[model samples]
Target: MILHVANPIYDSVFKYIMSDERISKTILSALLKKEVVKVEMRPHEYVNTTRDTLSMFRIDFAATVREKDAEGEGFKDRVILIELQKTWLDTETLRFRQYLGAQYSNKINIRKDSPKGFAYPMVAVYLLGHRVGDIEEPVVYVNHDVFDYNGEVVEEGKEDPFVESLTHNSIIVQIPRLKGRVNNRLEKVLSVFDQSRKDAEDKQVLNIDENKYEDDADMMYMLHRLTAAAADSEMRQDMNVEDEYYKAIEDRDTAIMNRDKELKHKDEQLQQKSEQLQQKSEQLQQKSEQLQQKSEQLQQKSEQLQQKSEQLQQKSEQLQQKSEQLQQKSEQLQQKSEQLQQKSEQLNNIVKSLYSKGMNILQIAEITGINKDEVAAILN
Candidate 1:
């Protein structure tokens, strides 16, 4: 039967074997029967006998048996070598042989001259998990002394005839075959190690009181610790993922804020340009109005200058007509002066006649005297 024991060191097969002490005691008690009182357990230890040796080996557990008295059917003192096997290594058989030899030679103290030969037999038991197939029964091999020649078996026992008859006991228990073999408390304990069962069923099997003893509390505590550690590790991984997610969101928000600020700056620049354009348009409108007013004033000034020029031209024509009339009047006055000179001449001739007809000298003198003097002067 296979039983699990709690192993804090987590050695693969040993951890499975050491999962529960009650299970361990039950299996060990059944194997050794009445000879075994308890099992001696220790952490796996490695010793280097040689400085240059790089090899290592471990002893899983040693059994302590009670001494037997001579009542013809009592318990015998003995020690069993227990091994938990998980992997199907090719060298396992040789390694198990080596372990048996070490246990036999290294553990027991011997005297060179003592007559009592070592009577305690070292048995090796392997509790295998899942590898051994089809063979439902436990495989048992007993080592015996045999004759060999050139690495070939020649005879049954020629070298050590005395001890050859007794069999060296070894047992290999395959865990896969325990499906329907045995019932009661032992089978329930074995169900926990069977991977074929559902997890809930396995938990139910572990909770069964008939399968466990009061001494299994320590194993339960160790299992709880392992479960808690696994849970904490998972929680830490989840937290790390959450932190990365939050950091990505923060980076995205920062990028969006920068883009918004850039857009706002561009909008402000556009607004300023629009305002400048409006101001320029207003200035152009004002200039256009001023130009229109100046054009109107220039048109009025041109009309006033044209009227003044027309008045000055009319005054010049009137002055030219008056100058022509003055020239004609002067010509007429010259003609009148010529006629008056002729009349004076005629008056002078008349006076000369009066003087020749012998008129009175005093009358002629009074009437024509002044005229005669003028007429004489003209004749001269």
Candidate 2:
């Protein structure tokens, strides 16, 4: 009989080992940090039409688990998803988010007593073959912790029914970091898929004996199956084929991640350029407004200067009309002076004629009624 070491990386073996009810319960309970008393397997292949297509997402295993609430009041149903994702990549974040969204959209039956529907809490557990994220911890657990703007945790957020109902818990187990004796429960549980193998020359040394973990029945059963698979010639060939297939996927994912990085860098540059152009446009508009204000001020000054010119022209016209009126009055005064001079000369001539015809000066004066002195002087 040929005895072989267990190789647990194959999907067939993992599924077969987890199909057992007792092992599945123990695994779920440990990962969930709760007591899982009941388990019911759900159909793994189903499309969630309320969200994106199911073609992009797949679940290795899923089940409805019943666990007692933290209050110790009663058992609650948790829709648990167990995923086998080998590598963690930057681009797979969106795909993961979409998968969770689809699961969240699954609603329970509508009750006649209440108008609203009920949704089950979701739990996600991922088995990673390689290191994916920046964190250094071997095992990672993610719980929805709420904080306020001041960075203080809110008690109400943890206790509120609405907030708690929407919260989903997740666990990430990294496998390549495993070596030596599996000490803890989580490490022992994860060891079922510990398929670290040696070359052909040291094939005998690569065997991980089931007796080493005799206390764990689940681990023992899983190791028995893996040893059985290693002994079979056809299953060994099939395992080689699956390994090649997973390698191809990893290669494709790497290429896609590189391309996505390039695209993201280009997008950042374009967004920066767009913001610069908007700023320039605003500055140009401000300059145009300043120029318009200056032009309006110049126009107002020109209008005021034009009004002053018209006022000066009107004063000049009034002055010219007054000079013409003074010239006409001066001519009239000169004519009147000449006419008075001529009348005085005619009176003197008449007096001389009267003196030449007079008998005596006295008689001439009496007759003419002139002064006696003026009459005598005219006669002499």
Candidate 3:
């Protein structure tokens, strides 16, 4: 049998169905896979804006879970804090952080029995209307596993408050990936959210085979609730309002993206211009440094030439002094030569005078100390 049911992916439909305590318990049990002894909803604020209408529905459930003892003789009841968050289109990473941080910081999450006031163990469940990264799984569970230095897995104590309070295990359901892959009971339960099951004529309603979930009480109850929601005049009106609201949001987002792209292009042009100017400045600086080096080399060469000129001037002065000394010596030699010539002439005249006086050659020679042959020659 085919039944037309309201699509719970719609914020209004989701809020309508999950607001019921029995429905919340059934969904939690299916997602957590734990036997929930009891569930009590903690207080949370809700806003009715189209944008905020259960866009993020966060509630705390003080849930008591029944677990079998290791000895298998008894069941132990543990109270845990389940921080349930359901989000539609927008699943910002920071938004998840903000919600978790708020929950962790809230003082109401503490246990009343402990003297040190230890916090209750927290488990976070995120129902996303969108996919996360490249993960193709419809359901992703993130749990903290302990390891030793030797890379061996260590078993965590079942009731360790310190480790459990600080860290949490998380379950993420990517509603879009739920498609036709219903391999388990959990998957079958989640198949209702498969957007592929949406009715062709109306997006607000989904077409599902009622026989597939006839044996499951929880599943049937959910289907009946959604069917009622689909028939409600107020619920259908709210869904329409949501449809118009999302359409406007989509248009707004498109406009913003186009503006961002334009701004990015301008930024790139400015950045290119900045880089070009920087390159030119660097080139000019390099040229200036080369010129300064050349100027320093010229100064050094000028100093060398000045030193060489001063050395040549000293050598020229020494050569001038030597030339003057040579001239003085030549003048002294001329005076000596003249004096020798005068002595020679006087001696010759004395010899001639002796010869004219008729003095014997031998007497002249003796007086003048001249050789006899030279005295005779002069007299003749």
1 against 2, candidate with superior TM-score: 2
Question: What's every prediction's RMSD, in angstroms?
Answer: 61.5, 46.8, 45.5
Candidate 2 lDDT score relative to the true structure: 0.55
Report every candidate's CA lDDT.
0.46, 0.55, 0.78
TM-score of each model, paired residue for residue = 0.37, 0.51, 0.67
Per residue, candidate 3 scores C-alpha lDDT tens digits across 130-179 of 88889999998998877789988776574478777789999999988889
Tell me how candidate 1 scores on lDDT. Answer: 0.46
Q: Model 1 over residues 95-188: C-alpha lDDT tens digits?
A: 4566556555553422233365533344556655445555755433445445456677655334232342133555565555664444544444
Worst 10 residues of 2 by lDDT: 47-56
Put the candidates in lDDT order, highest first: 3, 2, 1
Q: Which digits, one per residue and each the tens of the lDDT, describe model 2 over residues 224-264?
A: 65566667777667556656655665665576577568756
In model 2, the runs with Cα more than 4 Å from the true position are: 1-6, 46-91, 108-115, 147-161, 195-206, 229-238, 247-380
- Candidate maximizing TM-score: 3
- Name model 3 segments beyond 4 Å from true: 46-54, 156-158, 264-380
Q: What local lDDT score does residue 270 receive in model 3, on the 0 to 100 scale?
A: 53
Compared to the true structure, candidate 1 yields what TM-score?
Answer: 0.37
Better of 2 and 3 by TM-score: 3
Name the candidate, 2 or 3, with the larger lDDT value: 3
